[model samples]
Target: MTMTKKHLDSARRTLELEILALQEQLGQLDHQFDQACDLLLGLTGRVIVTGMGKSGHIGNKIAATLASTGTPAFFMHPGEASHGDLGMVTRQDAVLALSNSGETQEVTSLLPLLKRLGIPIISITGAPYSTLAREATLHLNASISREACPLNLAPTSSTTATLALGDALAIALLEARGFGPDDFALSHPGGSLGRRLLLRVADIMHQDQQVPRVLPQASLREALLEITRTGLGFTCVTNEQNQLLGVFTDGDLRRVLDLSLDLHQTRVDQVMTPEGKRVYPEQLAAEAVHVMEENKISALPVVNQQQQLVGALNMHDLLKAGVI
Candidate 1:
């Protein structure tokens, strides 16, 4: 084979080997997985993940995924734990230790201390009968037939299986604990997912005087002034009780002009869109975007349980608020 063809062959072989390793893990999901989930779910404190070398790298990512998904976890390096970081692990927490051979010295050395603390231990190891697995409260088998490396000395396929197993544990615990997108969003407040799930219409809408509104009996000229003053592109038409009747927008103005109707002689109610689409203050801002996209309308009036106007928002407001 040419040099370029040789490189392509190696890449494909590596991926195929990793794929087979993950496929092997699928059938190994058994009762031990359930016990692992149960142990994590019952914990009042965080899930502490610890490992050495490549295993440690995978453990850090696993902890991050767990924390962001609502499981509440952090990674602890085994070498650090041996030094003084052992103080961070409490009896209320569960320890997830990763070691492909189950004989990693830095990790195994901390086992006796973990046992003395009465803390539960969960092991992710390739060797089911290794020392770490035997010492664990529960063991998850992340065994693969061989490493993707041609020499089978590097930690390639083994680390991938370990990472996948960790993800499986985190997701299972997330579902069992009734964790939802809103809960996940709270933990990730600075992210776009959080904005989509937690941002509400009340948080972004213009209220009170900022809302352009006119009485149903008002002339079209008066309503136009309200829309211009508030710059919301539309004005709400309400009755004396402040209940919404309809909306009049720039589009309505254009259509009326096309008909050669006298703007000064028109009543606001005569051309307003009565019972137009409305949203509640408590609805998600993302939902507001969905409504706007579906209706091809730029603005929506907010009403409360009593059907009285409380606020107003448009596509521009949502875009500026990052809900779009």
Candidate 2:
């Protein structure tokens, strides 16, 4: 199909106008924005965001973002509030009202009750001089000079500005609450992120009797037996103190096979790699994964700082932990 220059020009024009409008709306990040953040952060109960029409949709998304990022928040539709949904907001909570014209009757009607209850009200509107903004303890000016639409009817640029303001509010709350990646993982614990943050080396490592192990003086055949029994590809050789001495792996077995050595007569010390790389028990399973990958090894013997053999973890454990 042949592309026309007229259609491309129209698309580019719309994008440029919206971008400029959004940048113009950045002036809303003033003291009023600070006051709104403070009000929401100081709330004893969840933040209650209320709005009408398209503003309501943006309010819902903002509420969800705040809720997931460690701030407690929820959206309350103004149209529903007129029909008794106002019960969602309480004296302990703070209300963030959104109305482009500041005259959304359904939203404005709740201000009197909110005021009487001493519930702080913050407003997001295009008109800072509007009734809703004037009545609010904090007013965020999400005003745009013109709509991207030619007839000045449709809400294209205005809605985008409102949504960006919502993002700013959510991120401010997230930062002020000290919400970090691990906190985020806690909220989203069923996915890959949860596995990475929550799963530890101890959680996935081979324990006690399951760990492949043999004494330093044990025959290579004995080490092979331990590896075969545990099926973990490696055997740890420890001293009388249960301290790590060396390690013999499947790779060592292949090398010994190349030499045609007598497995029963060959001592493990002769075939083993002494003082092999090891990890601590409390180390992050992800870090263990990095060590294994960097060295091209499949397993690592976990030991204490004093070098006692405590645990063994393999690539399979990391794979299960989603760190691989």
Candidate 3:
């Protein structure tokens, strides 16, 4: 069945209400937020995030963000904690407890153990006077004026407020820990941004015999043979001293054929692109990718400080390395 206009309009209205509610809830961030960050930043062990239901889902994501950003945190279900996961929380650890009404039976059940361990507790709650907040070492008021549901019961605005507060706490702790992109990338090594930031050009480029190159005085046939044998789709034309002189590629050969030139009689220097794009060996493979895209080229020759050919990389190399 197709969706009706009423369905889309209802969803949009809910989202709009949630956005405004979140904006209103943001005003609740105050001195308690700063003090809570101080407690988390001083932690030597992990941050134990515990919540119930929807709050548990948001807490899981918050814990991931906190861990990735260098805060060293993990989410432990309070219900599970009561059943023996409490062993995961050391005295050095800090706890982040979430409950919209400031009193979830599963979460409140852990307060005694948390107090016994002497672990600091940061409570994210709407009711500052509730049991959870009253027992917390640092109480962050995430109180929202109302839920986005017209009936004012479903967790819409309250969840948004909780999520925003969680993000603020994670980011604050990240800044306090002096976290940088490299630190962040270390934890997200499988992502593209991590690969781009952590991987070196030498890690992906064709190093020795795989590099396609030919002497400038070589015949067009010789260069074409090197390009085909290496499967780089291009060959670097270098002087006898191995200094790059030009580059010969399928595109250059296309232009050369248009001249109706004699391949057997032609030196690669005569038909190669004299001003073809080049990259330094020390440059990042990501930068080379950018250069290739900008110039609309498929391959680039890696040069040394002395402008001597050192390596050869192609778009295919990047593709094989999962970089492009």
Candidate 4:
């Protein structure tokens, strides 16, 4: 069948209804929302999320959002909870249950056991006076005016409202706990943000024997040999005291060669870049990448507070370490 104006109009109406429902729910948040957040923030154990069907699917996403944003949480299917999964929760933990009607049998069936265990319950329900809401320690109203579905039978607007509320709770808790990007990176170690934040210069830089170094008095030819030996395409020009004086790279050599300078007699100091860009061992490799990018250079020497060269690194090193 050809897509027509009726279908288009119906789709637009559905989204408009959902948006209006979320706006209404946003207006409904009051002290109850704050109370739920306070309870979750005070928990010593993880937040246990439970629901049935669509709510369960939404709960899974909510739990993942919570976990990534500094809140320890996991979704436990309510049906599984009544069988034996209830053991996963303890008195120290808090439960956040979802049921638009606030009367889902599979979810409400765990009320007595949760009460016996003394675990605090925060219910997200459309029905304020339902059994689940009345029994909860804190009730968050996810009540929506109507479903986005034309039949008014599916959980379209209600689920969207619940998801938005879940996001609001997670972000509020994240800010209250002073959760920052570095802390978030810890929870996402395998992600690019973690690699950028956690990887340091010392972890990827070449140390000691791997560094190409030459005394300032060394001839350009000698520095060239050192660069070739280390395969770093550059050599650090240092004084007798081993303090970095300058850097001589292939680019410098090219410039010198164009000028017809005698490589065998020209001293390294004559062509070296004076006391150039440097990094520290404790600094993030990502910072090294920034420096390299800003200057359009491929290599850098790692130095200490005293300006002593401790290590060296290049673009290849960053790429190999997955920091680039």
Candidate 5:
């Protein structure tokens, strides 16, 4: 086979082996899994994860996932823990240890100290009877038939199984604790998901003089000037009291142009879309995206509870705010 073909075969074989390892893990789940979840749920403190080498990397990711999903957790490097980092763990915290063979020196060495603190130990290991597993308060089996590595010397299927099991534990805990999207958004406020969940129309809309609006009795030429000045592509037609009456957009101008009406003489109210699709200031920016999408419009007039025009927004505004 060509070198490229040989590489593809190796990759495929590796993936197949890892997939089988995950499938094997599905059968290993027992009441111990439920017990582990119960222990974590009852904890008034954080979940402290620790491991060495490949296991350490997986432990870090698992810790992050657990913390972000509502269960507070952090990764503690086993080697560092033996020095002075052990001070970070308190009796209120539980230890989630990872060791493929369940006997890594760095991880196993901390078991006694953790035990002395009366901390609960949850271990994920390939060997169910290994030192770490046996000493653990609760053990999770992450065993695989063999490594996906051709020589069976490198960590492959084993690491994949351990990571998958960690994810399973986190999601199970997330559901049991009744964690929802809003709670998740609070933890991830800097991300796009948080923006979609937390940002309101009032937060991003152009308001005050920045809002493109004109009186209904104003000439279409005057409304066009407002739209051009504000650069929002649309202008709201409002009454003297600032209540929204209608909206005139680029699309409406195109249609009006087809009739060759005089822009300076025609009233904006006569040509505007009467009581067009609108959004409220307090509505979610994501909801504004939905309304604009459903109505096939690019801009919307923001209204208050009394139907007063308060702000204006367009798809471009949502795009800039990362709501798109």
Candidate 6:
């Protein structure tokens, strides 16, 4: 085989091994997994994850996943726990220890102190009979038939299985806790998901003086001027009571131009899309996006419960807010 072909084969073999390892883990799930989730769910304090070496990296990610999903968690370095960091642990907290061998010295060494504190320990290990597993309050078997590493000496299929197990635990807990998108958005406010779930139309729309609007009797030329002045690409046509009568957009202008309508003589409402698609100020900006996409429109006039035009927003505004 060519060098490139050899490389591809190695990669494929590694993935296949990891896939089988995950399958084994899936079959290993039992009451122990259920009891572990119950313990985590009932905890009054945080989940403190600890490990050594490669296991430590996996532990850090598991802690973060647990934290972001709903269960409060943080990674604690086992070596540091031996050096006074054990003080961070309280009886209210639970320990999640990781060790493929089930006997990493740094991690196993902390088990005694954790037990003395009356803290519950949940261990994920390849060796079911190892010291850490035997000492744990609940043990999860992350065993794999062999490492994906060709020599079977390095951590490969083992870590993949452990990570998958960690994710399974996190998601199961998330579902049990009834964690929903809004709750997730609270923890991820800076991300696009948060913007989609949390952002409201009122938060991004132009209001009052900034809103481009013209009286229904206003000439098409005047509406065009209003659209230009606000740069919102559209203007709302309303009456004396400020009730929305219609909306005229650049596309409407194109069609009107095609008809060769006299812009200065034509009433704004005569050329407007009567009672055009509208959105409420309190509605999610994501919902507004759906309306725009479904109707093939670029802008929406924000209205109140009484159907009075309150504000306006365009596709550009939603795009700028990262809700697009």
Best by TM-score: 6
lDDT of 5: 0.95
| TM-scores for every candidate against the unseen true structure | 0.90, 0.81, 0.87, 0.85, 0.92, 0.94
Where's the lowest-lDDT run of ten residues in candidate 1?
185-194
How displaced is residue 121 in candidate 6, in Å?
A: 1.0
Sort by lDDT, best first. 5, 6, 1, 4, 2, 3
What is the overall TM-score of model 5 with all chains considered together? 0.92
- Report, for every candidate in turn, its global Cα lDDT versus the true structure: 0.93, 0.87, 0.86, 0.93, 0.95, 0.95
Candidate 4 lDDT at 18 equals 96
What shift in Å separates residue 321 of candidate 4 from its native position after superposition?
Answer: 1.8
C-alpha RMSD in Å of predicted model 5 compared with the true structure: 2.0
RMSD versus native structure for model 2? 3.5
> Candidate 5 — which residues are off by over 4 angstroms?
191-197
TM-score of 4: 0.85
Clashing pairs in 3: none
Candidate 3 lDDT tens digits, 1-324? 347887888889888887886787667778888888887777788898999999999899899888888888899998888788998889999999999898899999899978987889999888889999999998988887778888999888888888888888888888888898678768988967777767667788887899899998888888878988999899998888889888999998888889988877899998888957888866767888999999999989988888888898888888777677
Q: Which stretches in model 6 have alpha-carbon errors above 4 Å?
A: 191-194
Q: Write the per-residue lDDT of candidate 1 for residues 174-206, one digit (tens) a residue.
A: 888789878877887886777888999999999
Off by over 4 Å in 3: 1-3, 176-178, 191-198, 274-276, 280-284, 304-306
For 235-309, candidate 4 gives per-residue lDDT tens digits of 998887778899999999899999999989999898899999999999999999999999999999998888898
